[model samples]
Target: MTQLTPSPAGTEGARDAGDPLAEGRSRAGWWHARWVVPSALAVGYALSVLFRLSLVTDQDHPTVSPDEQMYLVMARFLAGRPTTEIPGDQIIPSGYSLLISPALRLTQEPVHAYHLIMGINALVSCLMLPLAYWALRRLNVSRPVSYAVGVAAATLPTVLFYTQYAMADTPLPVLVLLWLIGVHGLFSEGSGRRRVWFGLLAGLAAGYCLLTHDRGGVIIALTAVVLLAALAFNWAPRVASALALASLGVMFVVKKLMTAWLMARIDGARPSEVGNAVFDTLANTQLMRRTVMRCVGHLWYFMTSTWGLGALALVVCVYVVFSKRFGLADRVVAFLMVALLAGITLAAAAGLPADGRIDTITYARYLSPLAPVYILVAMAALYRVRGWKKIAALGTAASAVTLVLLAVLLRLAGAELVKSYFVVWGLPDATFLSSLWPANGDWGGFHAGRTTVIALLVLAVVLLLRLLAGNRRAALATGVAGLSLAVFAGVASAAITERITEPRTKGTQGIAAGFIEAAGIRPGDRMVMDDGLVWEIRATMTFMVLDGRVWSRALNKNAPVPAEADVAVFALADQQAPATDSWRNAPAGWHVDRDVREHQFVVWRRR
Candidate 1:
């Protein structure tokens, strides 16, 4: 929200002031740069919101991925359940569900509650827009470049995809952004009181980030690393460094102590198997190599998905590091990025499955908090690129890289490399770019894939032009167009994926809900479900009636039915329909009361 004074017309540098083309371009740049790009960004925000709405049905409500149900179940507990009863099987922190609780408390309908949670996520995630702009401005990036960065932060496919879910990923970028800005302020601000306040605020933001997700601990650790780096290099005042460290230490210790206490209070209620699994997973270090490999792969896909912004950020950070005039804040930002890299690597290590699932899908969400910073660095790099010759050099290099990448992708179209990249990173698990540039089909996916790349390339080309003509007009126009296209790509991708996948997700939820309804599952009914059922169904049932008498038994072939239960639910492996036959292995005296076809689950009433 910082106000920037629009530079006067023709004040921008000119290569040939007497040349008609140069003069005209300068005037055009001045004219468009002031209003057009920002206006387009505002429009992108609106479109992003609408696209989110399109994805907000029961099918895509939380997400088809079972993790969303866990958040919902946790939120249900926060809304109206005893601490002892909350499921601790999932090791995720409670901050996200706690955020969703207010909305749930206001609405009994699950769908309405989901809508509110999505809206909250969208708003929180959108905070990146202002934060990006402000961060770029702080770095002395021009208005035009900064606006593009803000727009990109608002419209990137990764940001949009996560916003549609009720996960902790959405709010993380905002918290990270705040922590970055706060750290930046500690040295930038001159007044002692203001610096103290900034340090406290930064620490608080770091603490909250840690509480929201385990990756948040990375922020706090990164801040401490920055302080050490600063002291080692004599970058900032000793007093300021001390204050920042003190504030962070207090918050970190306080949060850990409080979380430990709360865990103890709820410990007796959690299943012993859950505790055993968590501790066992934490102690294992045998898979360290696999964890590192997945982390590296995750970073690669993250760069690819974000339109090469990650590469751009790396280029800028390298430039800053090698620059003779780089200062304390520059080192802070650079080290912060390093800390993130280390933290993320550590997170992936901690999250490695003892069962060897070892996929990086969840790690991408952890990496999302770095997106705004990536945008800021890229924008700043673009802003610093001056002159026609320099622009051409950079553009040529960029174009060459893009061409080689595209060619490699085409050549490897049916190869395992492309497929494995998506799998390792836990992407949709479909063929890479299959939805967009389908190897087996048409160009209809252009809006989902190529348009975004084309737009960014266009923006890159215009950045080169700005170096020669210093025309803000062309830069602003192409930048806005590029960003608009990116937004379109994101919305189109969301729509396409939703269309193809929502039916299955919705079908599962509907079948589960329908079966429960048909079986007349009242609040106090003793309901037995297979302990081996997907977490989604179990969590969904718990969320349906927080205080219900739900019990889990290993209801597989020959497993005994709970004598105290009035009803039970079971699911079969793939291709088998949910029916009485699906439960043929069930103990005698159980009659199928309802069958959920989509999910292959059945409810049985004791006869």
Candidate 2:
């Protein structure tokens, strides 16, 4: 048996001589190549999916976030009556609910359906890894460097966490990354036809973003500005113009469709209230300054809290800038980062209210898409350091640290802050990690687990350093080993602790489903649930309007309950309106039913 030696630089030069872009492009095709980064992303995301599924063990019944419940309720309402009041319009776009309706139909389980859709969203977002690598390579970065960045992005905790949840951030980032890749491709390899195709993709992305959430519109606007600036600088005027046109056309079409749908639904109902006073107040400098400050304060908390990894990377990038090792790409990245940061600041200044709660939630999830960019910039800075082994070692170390910290923070703090942050921002907390640490728990176990994970991570980093200084191939192998071990240990620890402390809520969905089935709902059977349980109930029975009472009460102050609901599902432990003898006393033929445990669901036949 003859042993084959590694290819020399001379042979590599010959390969490149055959085709200039060949070497760069070949990296994309390499087994552990830049393209393979998406595979790692897929693995991470798969873990996220499993973790989320574990949280909602019963597929027939699922535990959904407030926003998700809102979507489910709205979608079910639209599917049946087509004339029901659209719930949570301000926080979430109607398009999302509409999109989710089809998924709900397939699963026949609201929570399961929600997670399934979110998993798809997460998978789509992970696809950005390969697309981003393609863009980086097109920008003339080495294939290995590009691949490394791609892998880093795939394994990013922020991205992985959000990917498996039913929220706008999952799809929004995927769209943005796709847009970036298209923009890069248009400038680098696109002909007139390619420009047109790229433009269409860009437009579709912008439209999707706009329809998904209000803040998403900001992404479109920023994209337009960036494209125009690039054109002005002669980067690719024709391509930019095409993209601009495509984006505008798509936005117009999406807006028209949404408006038509809204108008059709609200034809007989009261018109949506327009508040010019609030709008005018937002234009005022004093109010704007206060709002901006409040938003910034919230943003600061979000950065330091669960998203500390992205924050740490950003801090590192800033440190790199001060060290005076900036390149042309770095400058461009810096400018784009500043532009995005400034845009967020300006948006907060323009829109957020002085009240801290509203501002924080509104802007918290908005920072997610920016997280990838922050990581990318940090990776770019890391790549600027000479020696491939150093790059690999540092990248591995940074990734390990980030993963460990995120896991620790999540386990210790619980997901209240994370969930609250997104809800405040009009986004859903759909990520797998978010569900791991529920609000009620000691959180000490999580803290302890994090400490252990971090220790292991630090050891892995030290081992990585040793591998780097000695043998090149061994360093690469060791880096991979360290990452694998850290991820495995972190996830396993979380799984075991979660299971031990809070075993899977047994057949929780069955009880909820049982209530719906027992109700014998009719076409015009109006139902109201205290905590939006009616949304889940709708999956089992037909109801004219299954209003989410809790969300309604929270969002609409002075909104009264309909006097003639066919059924009322109330939680026994509801603090808002506790179950009492008076509550049980209804009209003479009204029947009240209790579940297996401490739960009360009523069925009232109108007399």
Best by TM-score: 1
lDDT for each residue of candidate 2 in 117-193, tens digit (9 for 90 to 100): 65555446656566656554443444444555565555444454444345556666666666554544444433567
Against the true structure, candidate 2 has what lDDT? 0.46
Alpha-carbon RMSD, each predicted model = 7.0, 9.1
Q: Find the candidate with the highest lDDT and give its number.
A: 1
Give the per-residue lDDT digits (tens) of candidate 1, residues 410-456.
44332323343322224531222334443443322222135235434
Question: Candidate 2: where is the Cα deviation over 4 Å?
Answer: 1-65, 77-83, 89-91, 107-112, 132-136, 139-152, 187-192, 230-233, 266-334, 345-364, 387-524, 528-565, 568-602
Q: State the displacement of the C-alpha of residue 301, model 1, in Å, after optimal TM-score superposition.
A: 0.9
lDDT of 2 at 395: 48
In model 2, pairs of residues that clash are: 165-430, 361-424, 361-425, 362-424, 362-425
Candidate 1 residue pairs that clash: 29-472, 29-473, 361-426, 387-467, 388-467, 388-468
Provide the overall lDDT of each model, using Cα atoms, as 2-decimal numbers: 0.58, 0.46
Clashes of each: 6, 5
